[model samples]
Target: MRKRKTPDFLAQAHDPADPNPWLALYLDRSTPLPDEVKKSWLTDSSSNSRQYLLPLLRPIARGFIILIQVLKIFLPRKWSHSRLLHRVLAWGLTRFVSPEANWLILRHFHLGAQILAFIAANSPVPITTTPLEPRNIDDLKDDLFVKHDLNLFNFVIRLNQALRDAGVEMHPPARVDFSMIRDPGLRLEDMPHTRLNFLDLQSAIELFTPLYQLMLTDNDFWRAANSLQLDETIGIYAARLMGAPEHLILVNNKHPLVPMSTLRAGYRLVLHGLSTEMLHSLLMDRKAAQEQPPAEI
Candidate 1:
């Protein structure tokens, strides 16, 4: 039998010269960003200028943000994840919130998290440079790249525990090892190598999709899980910030790392008041432009 070739990403993961694992992962895209665009984004500006406003409007925007946060404290914990609550809030904001306030909050609060995560992961900090694997989950408790508002580390830990308690089993031929549950300290590096392909991705998604759906629907689980649900616009913006190509951003591409069902649920719940056309332009993949036909002279 011919020896199987290692995927470029997996090979890169093992490369010692690659100091920053997260950056390596970002660059390992099946559809990569153009070199020029990537360079411009890195060198030109760290943030969107439109995401800011005149200095005078800053205080007003801050007040609105604080009011929202204060209101959230008074809300019933269960209602925090309620779809009805999400829609109601979105609707009210759409009707009452100023465009500037909305943009400021989403940009500063939502996209800001992603920006911080990117910087932390790529920084020279040794702990942050560690490869993002199951083993290092505990170390990443406060990490922005891996742990979003939801505290993904705790979420994964709780999820694994929930699966085991529920006696959930994987499909035939792939018995549920519950490895993550069994060995709380288990690391991805310790596991045997297995080729990851589209089929594998599909199977994983299928297996976990229902579990995620159940979690979202279960008020008790959500409250105990302590996950933070984001607005659709913020979710979309965060995706773009993660170096997701324009095609994926426009279609709201569902990366396997996060559940697609959850993302769609946010879109339905929160009205960001952003048109799809505007979003497409904001996150346009310059690389994709190469595929377009030339304009007439």
Candidate 2:
């Protein structure tokens, strides 16, 4: 008897409609910005002066940012598990800057940087030493699957676990079974059989939105800290000071448009705002769950 072929679980999990369309919408490059936001982002002569001044003060800023990044790396892991510390950090960060800026910066600057880096790194590069060698598109696809797709899958899994710890129970849509691949340690070849249905997309969004909000609330402090800018200056300065990989990638790739940072910042604001709204809804759900009567046997 011939052995049956192993199914492509990843392909089976592809949903054109997307079980959480908001995630895609939030990530999309074509999403439009509001008029007022457009105006706010426009920098004048004063803005240019401030931007120029930032580099002169970079030595001082660099030291301060590095200290903060160090604290962020170490302190969060050590203290984050504490409920009090979580609340305190959340409260402090929320007040440190405008919520508007917080939302804008993450969607636009942070996520954009991550996406661009992923694209550039995964895109085909010439084998400069062997000029005649053909570019391998297969390698590019494999890299994207392993680096981008797998990493995102694991992130969503982790995010779900974090929500559960906070007393909010959320699962992917019934039509989409992620259980087989839920193990964080699972390798690509070890990936189990699963199915994804785009018809159940709305339900998945409804289920996941609360958890997404919790994530935003949890990261609000860090977001606020990173979102700060002086006029024309982009937050890439702070990222560079902290030795962020995104800055290095951007430099290496030589991305044609510096203004993409501005666009990214604007997009982040909208996405963050949406996440904040979701967080509010999640709180309400938690409250309702707490107040619910015990189930009859």
Candidate 3:
């Protein structure tokens, strides 16, 4: 699945301006930003390669990510570095940075790279770059990545089947409800629109956090760093910061280890049979641009 372009940072990364890390990280797409932060981030990201080399370091980056997730999961405590960051950092470093593991770390920049850098230990660093796969999370064939069936190729294919079964067409439903739920055996049409709970399509992805963790562990550091996966991850980091909209049209591009999802050309992921005009509007962000304008827009 292409990383969500909506800029949700929490599941990805926390925006600088966000006051609450947990809340900021988890906010849905369509969330508003405090203008000041947006401009700062825009400039920070595009400023220079040196300013953003964090993406080049994967082990520490994933460590930072695991740190935040662990903190969020077990918050309201002392939250010590020894107890938190160290543990997750240890895990990430062992997984991606280990020289012994075979992966394409040298080719593309993946989200795992920055995440590795962010949480990697600054002191007692390895001088020879020896292999260190964390306990119970080894890259062996019996590891979690294969155990959970979390490969991108599989994820996209499954999602494609879902879209096919839904009979997804070029146009979104004119009166489609964003929030809806179905009772056991309840037909989708039987439920009133107002009774539906808003659906965050990303929820489907969240169902497999364990799998994503496996994905985090199995990747090669340098390859992920160059792929612009961090950029995509950061874009998601930004979107999480922004929060969700009243509605959204979800798409899963299903490509992997190549380009980050949200940053790639939209045409690559637009549903196969969409009309030219509709596809153009979407890729241009023109069709939905005026949607109840931003109050400020």
Candidate 4:
């Protein structure tokens, strides 16, 4: 009999496969900053974007900002200088200087930074990252159908089958979103916009956390984490039956853009955020049946 594989969380990266597969995005030469601005900014550790955009108003903003000492004693830290100053500066920059702030910078510079800046300038910036991230269900499909040979839906079906053979059955009433991939931008079709404006995608990813984790388990995540640490992986995997390799193999898919290892980890992390009850509902019916009802004797 083949020895069963158990997950080892710490062993996978650098030595083997790191599931995040940051290599693609990390090593990409493309940067969000414009070519001219990228060169000037990357070289300067202390490049003050405001220094260039609002030189005349900097001194006045500085004085207004110092008033933060008084605000600190009365307001939340979020409203303090470190965070609030940027907005105060932006307000002072745009209002006292630019009058109209540049949308291009506001979108690309990072939302929190821009948000504080907008608040400082007392302006409102439109949020653009939503409607761009793939839904949790779509994310699975993107992994299986777009990135790999088996469609994610089919891949999940296989996982359910493997579990059934082990005398474990996933529950009823599954929902899926299989919309034709739409680019939030005009430039890309179905592809995640090469120019997704959010400086950090985590905020967007958080929205689906509950649904993401409804399908995964702590053990599943630990295994996926291990897979990332090990280069032995071709893709990512999570199973309702923690001990089932067949189920694990079914859920994780291998593809060029999203390696099996990376997507597996991504999906697992998304699941990590889901309510454990969601996973238990699908995986625990037999266990639930065997349990005796609360007895009062």
Candidate 5:
């Protein structure tokens, strides 16, 4: 198990007062900004000759994502899952991608996995997905499937969270079954053979370092990634299948061209507003149902 190196920028002390220090980097203007944070704003290519071509290369990054979506359709599914290709992509990410960007990518996976595991444990119905036990970056290079699983599980968790928030009484899925996700210590070594679905194209999307690096900075990359909406809808339909179709908000794939932190803040704001409206509507319906007199047997 090769250990991943922590980025200097992320390793620095953040404002302990801020609830989410990493997120505060983009959102909270008042948050403490250290020198390392300022330095991270520079492009990875800033020190090299390629810095001159950044303007031209930067615009190409947007087109690359569109190109990949089209290209994947014509290519065989297996071609994207090649272990050698994944290793090459990992090397590019390690070398060319900024430390902050790499950290965010890995951090996104870890956070997403943890949230999904939480939802799976508390789900009223079984979320019969594979346990997303990801290895460290080096081990992941040879098996990108774990990354794909994380994305899919995250999609599930987002819906589950939304459901739980909407007055659903959630409980452990089974009386004696040990399949549900719990603390990491009890996680299965590998998912059962029947659960393996070798169709995670999200990993391929993530490994496009050539195009992604051209986004100039980690924040820019975050903007581009969010605009693409690659992983947003992964488990939505599955969530609908579980229960309360009306409770889940309709996904809005259109992301504005803005700084990633700004976009994230805006996205959350929209979700909160919508959730409040939904909750009010649900409460009214429940009140009306209760007010109705009993029907004849």
Candidate 6:
């Protein structure tokens, strides 16, 4: 039997030179994110990005949303929850999704879990459920992402820090365990070594369309994986109660349009696919760090 090679995600995780800046927000925040980067993520915009295309894509997104809505009327309400559907999605993800992409997707759930738990713990009003499992994201079935949303991970971190400054004790999420990602259930090792170097927005839309549609039908798997939208009402309410600064408090205030929301979500989702210039920068930074000579003792 041929020797099994280490997966890109495993190597990337263990690499001493962390390439992705966003990871710092959750994994290590000793270094603050730059203002421009922070602004860009807040608005989901950057100089070289394709947000300009949303105008053209909106009508198409509206049409697709309508079609999915119509199709749902005819299909089994829970058809998206089929175990086989998830299996097929998992197979494609492991084989075609880049290591960085997979890493982001898996990490998002962990981060989201932490934020939800933190919010639940400190909310002025009581939360009925404390969501620890990533799957518990299905609890967000009533919420939705809108245009120009704040990155939830960023928002939570800022809120936590703000609350601490105001003399409130905070409940931080459990430390992330990268090793758990190698579990057989996740199948991260199955990814090919020669995965694509770029992740485009269209590719993300194509990849997530079926899952997104299924999510709309209230499928647990995709809803948990893709539709983890934070409730603006709850988030804002909590932020105000906790005395977080107006600057630190943020939410998806844009009106919901399923098609446009999906496209906007797809735009953000492409980052999970590691297709953005920032992701490329991370990979390049890691490579450069690896190639540098060891420092003398």
Predicted structure with the largest TM-score when compared to the true one: 6
Error of 2 at 1 (Å): 77
The candidate, 2 or 5, that scores higher on lDDT is: 5
In order of appearance, the predictions have TM-scores of: 0.24, 0.22, 0.23, 0.18, 0.39, 0.44
Q: What tens-digit string does per-residue lDDT give for candidate 1 at 1-297?
A: 123232333234455765744345346545334332232222212212222322334344334434544554666554423343334434433343333222222232233333233323322221121223323212222332223334433433443455467665212121211111111233222222223211121122222223333323344333222232323333443343344344333333334244332323322212221222223233334324534699999
lDDT of 5 by residue, 1-297 (tens): 123232344345566775543434444443222233223322221223233443444345445655654565666543433455557666655545444334334433443454344445445544543444444445557445334534553555665676677766543243322222222332111221121111111222333533333322334334334533422342243233234454344334333333243223223423322232223233334435646799999
- lDDT string for model 3 (47-151, tens) is 232234334433343454455445445553332232232344335433323121111111111212222221121112211111222222233333322222233
Please give the lDDT score at residue 144 for candidate 3. 29
Clashing residue pairs in candidate 5 are none
Please give the TM-score that candidate 2 achieves against the real structure: 0.22
Q: What is the C-alpha lDDT profile of model 4 across 1-297, one tens digit per residue? A: 122122232343543554433323333443322232222222221223233423443343334334433444565433312223233333332322211112222222232122222112211211122111332222323222112212222333444455566664332213211121111221111212222122212222222222222222333322334432321121122132132343322222233234343223433432322212122222233334435487798
88-151 per-residue lDDT for model 6 (tens digits): 5455544554443444444344434444444555543334332223332132232323111224
Please give, for residues 29-93, the per-residue lDDT of candidate 2 as tens digits.
34233322322222111133234533444344334444444555545433332243334333332
Off by over 4 Å in 2: 1-32, 43-61, 65-89, 103-297
The weakest ten consecutive residues by lDDT in model 1 span: 174-183
| Global Cα lDDT for candidate 6 | 0.39
Model 6 stretches with alpha carbons more than 4 Å out: 1-66, 76-78, 124-193, 196-202, 214-231, 247-265, 268-297
Model 3 Cα shift for residue 51 (angstroms): 4.8
lDDT on C-alpha atoms for all candidate structures:
0.32, 0.29, 0.28, 0.27, 0.39, 0.39
Backbone steric clashes in candidate 6, count: 1
**lDDT, candidate 6, at 22:** 37
